[model samples]
Target: MNSIKQTCKNVKTLVDSFLNSTTPIFCTPTDEPKDTEAWYSTWEDNYIGDFLNNSVVKAGLKKIADFYCAKQLDVLLRHSSELKASSYPQLYRIYKECCKRLGFVKMPKLYITYQIFGINALSLEVKGHKLILLSRMATIRLNEKELRFILGHELGHHQQGNLVCHTVNGLLDTFNTSSEIFGPMISDTIEVPMKRWCRQSEFNADRAGYICCGDIDAVTNLFLKLGMESVCSAYNEYKELEDAHPHLQTRFTELKKIHKTIKVNR
Candidate 1:
């Protein structure tokens, strides 16, 4: 029993380390339009473009559009003192608009650190504080539009503080550390559903990002770039999970569909 307990502890440590090392996969946009143009051209020449132009993509995009409309610029900036008062007023306005549309009321405390390994953004709902950490490496490289979208994505998690569900999910993850008798059963009963829900949440957040950025094209481009970067990264193994967030092409397609459908209905 003591040995079993020790083994469980070791497994927990290993799992935690694995999770911590995994960074939020995202791509930093190039500062120059020419650079972006070149990359875009290359991407379009590749398979991603083919995936984006598919019927399934169109359907997904339409689903997002039907669910929510784009947010207004003024309403978005109401809580953002730093952004509203900045020289880049337009950028801040865009950010605020996305937040408003997504009904993101609370601002998570932002932390930056070079020491953090793997992830780009983390949203933690602790006892009293909702904390968000953005990777300095990721943030320093993003264009204004990309930055706002990423921030809005984190805000999406903040708004989704359905505590009971989160707590249950956490407990299940912990319990599945060992116990061969219960491990596979618990994973199937809990982890699968949790991951599916998380993926759905990502779609919602992507919609929020498009609304905040005020440009589906920008959002799609950013997604494509990020996907490429993810594929290039050492942590690219996460992408191998069929159950992870929908493929990048699917997401981009969904966004496009949302934009088109909303425009038609409006």
Candidate 2:
């Protein structure tokens, strides 16, 4: 109990120092090569490189090319509340600040929808229109830095060229509904590999989150909110084969390792 209290105290001290300091202590959008080349998870880069080249994935992409239609209108017009500087001043500031710090050439639209519980956030690029969607619970529960982490993580998908692959997964889910026709075919060619790649992609995004939030303690705290600190087992790995996101513990461990390396280098 004392250890936990001490840790929290330490984290609070670090966060206060970070916010109060004038100098930039972490990488900013100006840090050249404004893309994942700077901070991509090496394993994720290699895996995605191979995943993109696979003849099956290439063929699947061709088949699903037409499904990349923009849905920003549907989200904006029919579903969620859009965040704009004129309206949601504070939240919008955080969104824009994250975009600038993350090196996004064009700011993506941000939107939020009601959700009673649980944090939810996602980003997508459809026909060149990019947007980030978040559950209202996220804005209500997370602090500004944690929110930056979420936005940065989502934007990282675009930075790392994972959007098309993500779109493929979304389309696959839609196709799975009519599994009698598309199941065996997609399951054989694209499903598992795509899911595996998507899980790995989270590591890349976590790195982006770390860079954007500029606070490891805040990142881990966000993970705690997501219930990702539990132990992971072999069974968890097997079950995660077709999961889009990795286990919380696995993600926490991976990010911790990354944060250690980043600290040493800095």
Error (Å) of candidate 1 at residue 114 is 1.9
Query: Which candidate ranks first by TM-score, i.e. highest?
Result: 2
TM-score of each: 0.53, 0.71
User: Candidate 2's error at 241, in angstroms?
Assistant: 1.9
Worst 10 residues of 2 by lDDT: 19-28
Residue 112 in model 2: lDDT: 83
- Top candidate when judged by lDDT against the true structure: 2
Q: How high a TM-score does candidate 2 get? A: 0.71
How do the residues 167-209 of candidate 1 rate in per-residue lDDT, one tens digit apiece? Answer: 3345556677767787786565446655555555566656555
Lowest lDDT 10-mer window, candidate 1? 35-44
Residue 106 of candidate 2: its Cα lDDT?
73
